[model samples]
Target: MARQRFGLEGPSHTGHDVGHWDGLKAGELRIQRCGACAEWIWVAQPLCPSCHAFDPGWEAVEPDGVVYAWTRTWRAFHPSAEVPYTTVLVELPQAGNKRVLGLYTGADDPVIGSRVRGEFESAPDENSWPLIRWSAV
Candidate 1:
């Protein structure tokens, strides 16, 4: 398989919670949840930040959400990343208002509380990691 290429070289993904990326590669949105307290966790953690439980596991979640916050970047932090891209904090109502951050691909300006849905973009290489982009719904 060709190495996955998402255009931009992402930051280091090495860590315990990196399994979330595997879910993306499989076209699923997975998030960590506290097995004990059942609280949703973001940015993936080995232990639940809320209940202090260990061995948190992943669960598939609905892709639909509302934009809680957003911002557009004019500067290219990396040469491969295009400027003027919008990043959004999406609140997943199904997941106890837990929020996930991703790039917004819609043409219109992002509005707080706007409905959005996740769209997984596959890497140029079949084996490369996939990404989740959001679109206005």
Candidate 2:
């Protein structure tokens, strides 16, 4: 099936999390890592949760993971979003078991521990933000 574009808005792409959107535009999955403790921080924080270090740097990680958990939503939260969409929490082993949330685009039901890969979709318009979609591997 073709890649689906979910009409959900993301967090502000400013400050610490700018690299994440930039990475998606460049076809990479960039995440922050604490320079001191090397701990992966998701949702992009200014300080490392583990070591509390300032100015954590960003690194490109492989967009491959397993479905740690998931849920199917029947409600359309946004105008661009459709009913019966699935969101999956993917566990990235390459990034120290850090889980990244993304939209699931597959026909079968979401099964826990299923291998999935990331697919970055550019925004339909300049005003909208890009997103990562996951597919079963």
Candidate 3:
């Protein structure tokens, strides 16, 4: 195996949540759920904080979700990502308030309480990871 190249220059999943992108590629929303309490977890943790259970598993989720929160980022953290990107906190119905953070596809069409869906974009290079971009509906 070789060291993976991350960041804007590499694949979209290169920065963080590489596993999440991998799941998306397989047509799943890939959320971490606690096997003990059956509660959903975000930001991907080794164990469920709610039940403190070491048993955690990934489950498929609906790509469609409500926009819990959003913001327009003027700063370009990644060179590949255009500036003024929309970042959103999506609340999945299946997760019961569990939120996933991702970049909005159409930054100009942002709505606070609108419905949105996820679309995973392929990386420019294999070294880069796929990105889950969102669009408001």
**CA lDDT scores, all candidates in order:** 0.78, 0.83, 0.70
Per-residue CA lDDT of candidate 3, range 23-137, in tens? 7667677887877798887777767888888747777887889898988766756655555666788888878778877777763757777899988666666565666778877
The alpha-carbon deviation from the true structure for residue 74 of candidate 1, after best TM-score superposition, in angstroms, is: 1.0
Q: On lDDT, who's better, 2 or 3?
A: 2
Candidate 1 lDDT over residue span 1-137, tens digit each: 11222364332455655657777877888888888998888777778989899878888887999999999877867765666778899999987788988888865789998899998887767545678888898
RMSD of 2: 2.2
Residue 98 lDDT in candidate 1 = 80
Report backbone clashes per prediction. 1, 0, 5
Candidate 1 regions off by >4 Å?
1-14
Give the CA lDDT, 0 to 100, for residue 57 in model 1. Answer: 84
Q: Sort the predicted structures by lDDT, highest score first.
A: 2, 1, 3
Which whole-number lDDT from 0 to 100 does residue 135 have in model 2? 88
Candidate 1, residue 16: how far the Cα is off, in Å? 3.1
Q: Write the per-residue lDDT of candidate 2 for residues 42-84, one digit (tens) a residue.
A: 8799899888899898889989999999998878677766677
Q: Which stretches of candidate 3 lie over 4 Å from their true place?
A: 1-19, 77-81, 107-109
Q: What pairs collide in candidate 1?
A: 4-128
What's each prediction's TM-score? 0.84, 0.86, 0.76
The 10-residue segment with the lowest total lDDT in model 3 = 1-10
